[model samples]
Target: MKRLIHFAACLACFTVFLLGPTIASAGVSKKAQSDFEKNLLGKDVKALLDMPAYKDGLDLYVDHKVDKRLDERGIDLKDLSKYLKDKGVGVERDEWVTITDAKIDSDRIEIHLGGGGEGHGASKNAAKKGAGYKRAGGSRINFRYGRDLTDADVQADTFLPLLGRVLDTSKIIGVVIPKDVAPQFQEAIRSRDVVVGMSYQMVLISFGEPDQKKVDDSTDDSLHETWYYLKDGHRWVVKFVNGKVGKVQVF
Candidate 1:
């Protein structure tokens, strides 16, 4: 009996050892991580930052951290306010860059840009001094979901809005839109307004899953959906006609 008990304890320890990492980041859905890797990895995207960025990552928390940092409101800013203030910007605003890597941790999704931060070799290769010196182009955007997450939380359509906080993936999956497309998308998310011509996916990203979803069957020909969302202490209604935003009614 003692031996059996000892083996059980050992098995418990072994189980913890094997499942530790998974348990640590269990809040992050594996599907969500996989989706990001499939979509963003090896993709060329435009930078959205208005200021200088660095090899060190810019941490973007989807939860209350934005409000805490007041980042969206900053007009005049220093280079790399979130990290590496002393170092020069590795990437500039609107610069086209590639996503070299992506990682989802227990608290954040770490997306690397321009080769996932500058390497020592790149920095040494271009040893020119002052602002004109060109270091390797690289930076990172760490998207933080502060609470327990689900696959729905980071699915491509909805996740893109949050991702717009750093990289403009307008050329997502090889579909290139205008330069202003991503910024407009980011604005839509901030305002939480469903605009006309927005597809069903865009609405999901900007407004999230509706509080209530119902199909309007009056016409009986084209597919129409009416979604209800509770935002800013009010219930708003959005009507989708033929899989596109048709009308947004506020109550």
Candidate 2:
């Protein structure tokens, strides 16, 4: 009986010796785990990446591939890009987009934004209602560790500073300020205001792609480029001389 007890103790020690390294390296760091649980999971985070979602959503992915594309899941996403090609704009860059859901596996964290992509039901519902279908876009960022993840990898990712690199840089079209813009360019963009002296680029930055554009070639030196915005019975005509706002007409 004493021998049996001694043998059991020896076997236990042997097991520990074999599994000690694995047990130590089984998971991530204490701080990473703590941050993920306390600051991440079920919490909203501003990834601060150049992910410009469509009015619907933008598809983004990280190095960690959590799953196949939603299109493979029977979503008719083939025409999504083609159909939304001409759509004016989606989410404004530099805004807090979303972190609707996240899936954390032993090796990676799969994060989803804007409901993780469009659903078939949503498209059908819009079609049923006799309205054009507008499914909000989403991104799936998979924080991957090619090898076993350590604390450092998770702490310094591209998207979440607390996590690892965000390997998604698709369709990032922000307001273009070709040159030095007005002092109130940001304010004007916020207020949707366009005044004289705002450069053509500033106006483009303030507003998105205009509805119409007409150029005046009558002058020899400086050509006047007229941009018009028409929406919901509101009309704005902005004339730019030498790329600077010369006149603004509202109707």
> Of the candidates shown, which would achieve the greatest lDDT relative to the real structure?
1
Q: On residues 43-131, what C-alpha lDDT tens digit does candidate 2 reach at each position?
A: 43333333322323333333323445433212223433442333312222233445566555666665666555544444444344332
C-alpha RMSD for every candidate: 10.7, 12.8
In model 2, which regions exceed 4 Å deviation?
1-17, 20-25, 29-31, 37-96, 118-133, 156-251
Clashing pairs in 2: 55-90, 56-136, 56-137, 57-137, 157-163, 157-164, 157-165, 158-165
Cα deviation of 2, candidate 2, in Å:
30
TM-score for candidate 2: 0.35
lDDT of each: 0.66, 0.52
